[model samples]
Each structure stands twice: as C-alpha cells, then as structure tokens.
Target: MAVASLIPPAPATGEPQSGCYMAATSDCGGRLSREHYISRGLIDGPELRVRGMPWQREEVARFSPDNLVARILCRRHNSAMSPLDAHAIRFFLSVEAGLKHAQRRSLSRKSRFYMTSGDGLELWAMKTLASLYSSGIEFMTPEHRFRDFEPPMERIVAELSSPNPCSIMTLSLPLMQDAHEEQIGRRAVSIGPIVDDETGELSGLLVRMHGIALVFNIDLPDKDALPETEIARPDMIDLIGMDRTSRIFLSRAKRRPEAWIVQIRLSHPRKDPPAGRSDRGCNRQPLRK
Candidate 1:
C-alpha cells in the first residue's frame, strides 16, 4: 500500500507509468543517468550480499555494488544527492570503527560517542526510498502489503531537496539485547516496507544492516510532531523493534575544540530473513572491518 500521488497514471489503464518517474519535478533535467538507489559507498570492496529479493532461490546472493544502479534520476538530480550519500557513508564507516573499538579490551566509555548531521541521515533515507521507486521497485511489495499504492514522488522530491528541515522520518535503535545481537552477522542487510493497518497506506520502511536496524517513516510527519521528550509516537508500529531514537545537540568544548562529535548507535537481534542471520563460519573471510 502506497500513499497517493506518485507518478501520473497511464492514459488507458490509469495505472502509474514508471517511465521517467521524476519527469514531473522541476529539479529533473539533463540526460537520464544511472543512480545508485542504494549508495555504492555502503559497499565495501566491490560487492555486497543481499537477500529477500525475488528471483533468488536461497534469498541470498552476492552482487557487485555497481549492479544496484538504475537509470532513475537525471544526471543533475542524481549528482545533487552526493552530499546525502557522503553523510550515510561517513555514518557506516564510523559505525564499523566504533564497533571494532567497542570490542577492544581496554575500551573507554568516553570514546563511544560520535556525531553526524541528523538532517543528512534523514535525507539519505528519503533519497533511498525515492530511488527504489524510480528504479521500478514498488512500495507495495510481496513482503508487506494491504492494497496496491504509490507514493507522491513530487512531494518526496520536494521534501528531500528543500532547505528547511522537516520530520519526514525518524531513525531509531533497539534498546540493548546481546542475545539477539550475537545472532545477526555484520554483513546482513534487510529492507522491507510497512503499511498502515487502518489506512492501508505505505507507512514506513525498515532497513537492517549488520547488527543494527533502523526504520524510516514514509508519511513525512511534522518535525514538531515529535516533542523533544518523546522518541516515537505510541501508536507507531515497532516495525523493527528498535524505535528508541532521540535528538541531541552538542557545543564545542575547550578541551577538543577542533574535533567534531558524532553519535554511533548499534542494535541487533531482530528477526532475520528466511535465509538466516547467523554469523559466518570461521573459515570465511570478513567482507570488511
């Protein structure tokens, strides 16, 4: 189930046409170019493993990161998304580094904190969702459905490109639970959509990577809707059982005025795909640190 207002409906059948999905937007121009719906930076080395996508027998297979590209956005629109991709890349890199440090025997509590632009993270999520749709992936996928629907592409684009901040979605982490964390392999990544039980509209998107999982809401709720004290609305479904997110701001301290702050949150143990989420065998080499 998708929220109304995606692309224009076809003249004969009234079905949404996938042709140049972003044609209606003013920011779209230049030649149609390949866009990595999923940031290539998220890929380490040359490839990454994916599961739960149709066409795979075991629901798991490795593909070169470049294979994820699609001729979705025009060259200009796609290039405009570079900053968001960089933010997301910095975030994952920071996560890998922090995780390695956390496992160190002589870890210090003070070293756990990090920071990045929350706005950039949110934009990354929106960009990811738009790219998926533009790449021919439907919002009403087999894994999650109510009624067939499509999102308002223009609105998603406007929200993503606009300068003013908006609460399009929230990213959250599970409250700790190593019992489940230990089961999820660091290379695991899962994504699925969510539908509103009542409205039957595409409500959110769930993305689980490594041990941590995050959900990005689809409705684009008001930034002020979430009071500073609350992480998520009680009525919002716990799509990934990891919704405890809160906003934080920091000021430069005299001790490390030159250093920037970034917050790295990790979660694990959510339900894995049909393929399984167990750690890789000891004989197999890790994809990356």
Candidate 2:
C-alpha cells in the first residue's frame, strides 16, 4: 500500500513550472513531450475511429491529435513506459476481436480472453488515469477540490514503473448499444469520488476507448463485508491459466445494434462497493448496464 499523494504541493517559485506526471521529479525543462491519452497503435486501423469529448460541446467528435495529446511526461519517463503501451494495445485488440466474434455468432454464448500480463494492463490503466488527471490540472481551482484531489505523483510513478496488482483493481467492458453512444464518447476519461455506506471515501476512474470501457477503483473494500445486493457482479467467463478473464456476450438478435455485452472479471472476486449505499446498504447505483 505505498500510495502517493495525488496532489503535490505547488511547485517552488524559481523551479521549473512543470514536471513529468509519472516520474514527478524530472523537470520537462520547458519542453514536455506529447503523450497519447489512448495508445496510437491501438486505434490506427479504419474500423476503430478515435472519438473524444469536446471541451465546450455536449457531443463527441473524431479525436484529433491536439484533443487527446497531453504534455505531461518528460522524454525519459515517457520512453520508459513504451512496453506497457504495447501490452495494453495487444490486450485490447484481443478483447475487440473476441467481442466481434461473439457478435458474429449471434447467440447468448460466453467468450473469454486471456491476459498474459495482467500487471502490464493494470499499469496501462493507471497511466491513462494519471495522464487524464494531469491534462486537466490547469482548469482546477480551490472550489474544485474533488478534481484536484488525487493520489500522490510519486506513488503513481512507482506503480507505473513497477505495478503491483494488489494496489488497484481494473475492469473493462464493451459499449454494445448506441443508446448512450453520444454520452459515452463525451466521457472518454472521468475521475470522481465514490462514497460508501459509512461515508468512507474512495476514488473511481473510468476510461472509455475504442468502444471498450475500463474502470479503476483505488482501495476497494472486501466483498464479503457488504451484502450481495449492494455489489454488482457481471457474468464472467474465466480465462484458462489466468485467474481472471474479460468476458463478453452478444444478443441472439443479429439485427440489433445493441447485441453485445462485455465485462472485465477480476480475479479478486471483490470490487469497490456500489455508490450511494445507505445505512442498510439497500439502495445502490448501477455500475454498468
């Protein structure tokens, strides 16, 4: 549980104004490199057109380099995490293919995909969360304390450099239906607070990329401590050898655009309690459809 303070104290007067979000020490030297919010290699093909939430608009548009690029990490730190980007790309590609296959089958059947490097994928999720958080630092004010609040940069850097699977939990699902398509892309990356029945605080980060949604929860509580009704569990197909699997299902109707349903099943079998749990933990917000 080596966690870093999400927000660092304001930088010193004479020091460099910005530093690498991952490393938290190396000054960009007034030249910060562009880091893709979503890996470029993952969306290079035509089928997967990139889309992002526009700053002022209520809709999502084709993602442009400027829209998704963030000048957060220095050259050295950015280069160090390249392998993670590649692993994440591969992991998502496998998932996309599995979803496509499930859709093509047009049956209420189950599908499972293996992740050879779960730690790598977890780090990728953490990196994306950190990147999104850092990109919006300028817009934050004292009143926006929730937005400014985050785990420490040093801890994040440590996780990105040497990820620990026990530190954070990650789950992924596909956007099967277009019912919320407009809102989905508009909310590409969002970080917020999740409060439990006892008013305990936890952080939630959601990242949607290429029709897939990845959700991360820090310091999740044990499942057995909460009632089953207060927890949301999706049907998951187990991956062979690995303890966890990314499960997907498609509706029987071939003509329906909402035929697909995807979910990320973690090995731990526990998740952060649902948002807004009353004293009895009777009412809970839906984690996903």
**Predicted structure with the largest TM-score when compared to the true one:** 1
Model 2 residue 109 distance off true place after TM-score fit, in angstroms: 10
| Best-performing candidate as measured by lDDT | 1
Candidate 1 Cα lDDT to native: 0.50
Q: In model 1, which runs have C-alpha deviations exceeding 4 angstroms?
A: 1-20, 105-110, 138-147, 165-167, 176-185, 220-230, 233-289
Compose the digit string of candidate 2's lDDT tens values, residues 1-289. Answer: 1222222233512334365674444322345688886676665443334333324243334454444577877655566567667766765565555434433434333435443344455666677667766876332222344344555456666555442322354443322333123322222322233333354343555555533355555544653443332331222222111122234321111123222122322222334332121323222232233
Off by over 4 Å in 2: 1-18, 23-31, 46-58, 105-116, 137-146, 162-202, 209-213, 225-289
Candidate 2: clashing pairs of residues? 4-152, 5-151, 5-152, 6-150, 6-151, 6-152
Worst 10 residues of 2 by lDDT: 250-259
lDDT of 1 by residue, 185-287 (tens): 3775556666767786777666766555555776646535532322332111111212221212221111231322112233433222111122222112111
lDDT for position 234 in model 2 = 26
lDDT at position 109, candidate 2: 38
Task: Tell me the deviation in Å of residue 51 in model 1.
Answer: 2.9
- TM-score, predicted candidate 2 vs. hidden true structure: 0.55
My TM-score estimates for the predictions, one after another, are: 0.64, 0.55
